[model samples]
Target: MLPDISVVLTTYNQGKFIKKAIDSILSQSFNNFELIIVDDGSIDDTKRKIDQYSDSRIKKVFKQNEGPSSASNVGISLAKGAWIALMSGDDISLPDRLQVQYEFANSFNYKICFGLPIIIDDEDNIIPDEDFPVFFSDHSFSNRKVFKRLFEKGNYFCAPTAFFQKDIIEEKNPFLISSLQLQDFACWLSLSKKYDMPIINKRLIKYRRHANNISSKNNNGRMEFEMKMIYKNILNNMTWELLHEIFPNQFSVASMNDKRCFEIEKSFLLLKQSIKSVHEVGCEKIWNYINDDVMCSILSTKYNFNYLDFFMETGKFNTNERDESND
Candidate 1:
C-alpha cells in the first residue's frame, strides 16, 4: 500500500548534514510516510552516506548534476502518496513536524500549508536572535487577494516547511525549471495565485544557515535579476489589458526599467490595500518588507534614479515617522 505522505529531499555535496536530515525523517512521529532522497550528482561521499541508510521506506535516486529544481521534479514524479512534503538535506525536521502539518492540512481541507522554522547554525545550534526581519512572517494567507499581494512583495515562507497535497503538483507542476536558485519561491508564488496557503504557527523545521547553502552563494546582482524575472513572468501571464488597468502610469512609462520600478511600487500599494482590507493589525509588518531599501535601491539603479529621493518625495518615510511619533 502507498504511504500517506511522500517526503522529497534533494541533496548535492551535503554529505556532512545528509545523515542528520535522513535520520530526522526516519525518526518522525508520523510513520506512514515514504522518504525519497535524490542525490544530484554529488562528488563528495554523499552516496556512501545514503547507502548506510537501509530504511525500507527510503527510496534513493541518483542523477546528474542538473540542480535542485530538476532533482525535486524527479522526486515529485516518483511520489505516490496522497501528500508531498519538501525537505532539504541540511535542515532538520522536528519529530512532530509532518504529523502536525498533515493533520492541519486535512482538518482544514487546505491544499497547501507551511510552518515557521527555527533558524540554526552549521553546528545545529539555534540562533539566539533569529527574529531578523523578513517579507512575510507568522501570518496566514487564506485568500487569493492577500496571498497575491504578499507574494508580490517577496517570498516569506520556508520551502523546507512546505506540506501539501500531491494533486496540486501533479495537476499544475508549479515548480519552474528556469528558477534554478529559487524554485521553491517560484512554486509558492504560482500556487498562492490559485490556492490558499495557510500557516501552521508552530516551528516545524530547524533551518540551517551555512556557507555552502545555495542562497548564501548568490551575489546581490544575480538575486535581484532573478527576482525581477520572477515578477515579470507573473505579470506577463496576466492579460496585458488587465495589467494596464491595474497599473496605468507604469504601463505608460517609456523605459522598461522605469516601468519595472513603477510596477513594483504599484505592487507595494496593492499589498497595503489588501492587508488593510483583510487584517486590522500587522499592516506595519508588511510595510517593512515593501519599503526595504535594498530592494528599492536595486530598482532605482536599474531605472537610473535615486530611490531614496523617490521615497522622500513620495513621503513614504515621513508618513511612517509621523505615525510612529503620534504613537
Candidate 2:
C-alpha cells in the first residue's frame, strides 16, 4: 500500500546528527509514511550510521556530493505519496509534525504548509523563539499583500517545517537543481505564485544553526547565489505593471538596482523559460530579488525598501546614487 506521506531528507557530512534526525522521524506520532534519505556524497561515516537503521519504511539513495537542491529533487522524484514533508539531516522534527500538517492540509485543502521553527545552536541550546516575527491568523496569503510582507523581510517560512503537494512542484518545475543554495527560497517564491501559502503556526522543527552548516560557512557566497536566483527566476518575469502593483518598493533607482539584480536573474530565467517552452507570466513575481550589491548594502543598511509604501507611491524609485553611501 502507498504511504500517506513521504519525508524527503538530504544530507552531507551530517554523521553527527543523522541518527537523531532519522530517529525523530521513526518515532513520529504519524507512523504511516516513507522516509527517503539522499546521502549527497558524504566522505564521513554518515553511511555507516544510516546502515544501522533497517526499517522497511526507510529508503536510502547514495549520490555523489551534489547539493541539497539536487538531492531534494531526487527525493521528490521518488516520492509516492501525495504530500512530501521536506526535512534536513541535521534537524529534528517534532513527533507530531506530519500528523499536524496532514490534518491541516486535509481540512483546509492547502497545497503548501509552513510552520514556525525553533532555532537551536550547535550545543542544542534554544537560542530564541522570536527569530520568527509574530504573525496574525488573518494575514494575507492569497494576494499581493502576502508577497509584500515577504519582501519587506527575509523568508518567513521555515523550509523544513513546510510540507507541499508533490504535484504542485511537478507541474511548475520551478526548482533548478543546479543551484546549491537558496533553493528553498526559490522554490517557495514559485509556490507563492500558484497557491495560497499556508502557515502551520506550530513549532514543528528544530532548525539547527551551527558553524558546520554549509550556509554558515559560505554565507556570502550563498547570498550571492540567492540574489542571482531571484533576478533570473523572479524579477525579470514580472512586467513593469505587475511589478508596480506587487513590488513597488523596487521602483527607485537604488531599489531598482536591487530590483535590476532581480531583473537580471529573472531575465536569465526568462531566456531559459522561453527556450524550454515553460514560459507563462505569473500573476506577480511573488519573490523578492537580491544581488551581491544589494546583499552587501543590506548588510550595511538596516533593511530593504518598504513594500506597501512602494506599492502606493510610484515616484519613489531609489536612485543608484544612494548605494555610494554604502561604500
lDDT per prediction?
0.69, 0.66
List residue ranges in candidate 2 displaced over 4 A. 131-140, 171-174, 212-217, 236-327
In every candidate, how many clashes are there? 0, 12
Which ranges of candidate 1 are over 4 A from the true structure? Answer: 129-131, 135-138, 170-173, 212-218, 237-327
| Poorest 10 consecutive residues by lDDT, candidate 1 | 318-327
lDDT of 2: 0.66
| lDDT, candidate 2, 203-294, per-residue tens | 89888877554335355445544544464445535555555566554443443446544453343233232111112121023123222555
lDDT of 1 by residue, 262-317 (tens): 45444443434322211112233234434788655654555444535444334433
Q: lDDT for model 1, on a 0 to 1 scale?
A: 0.69
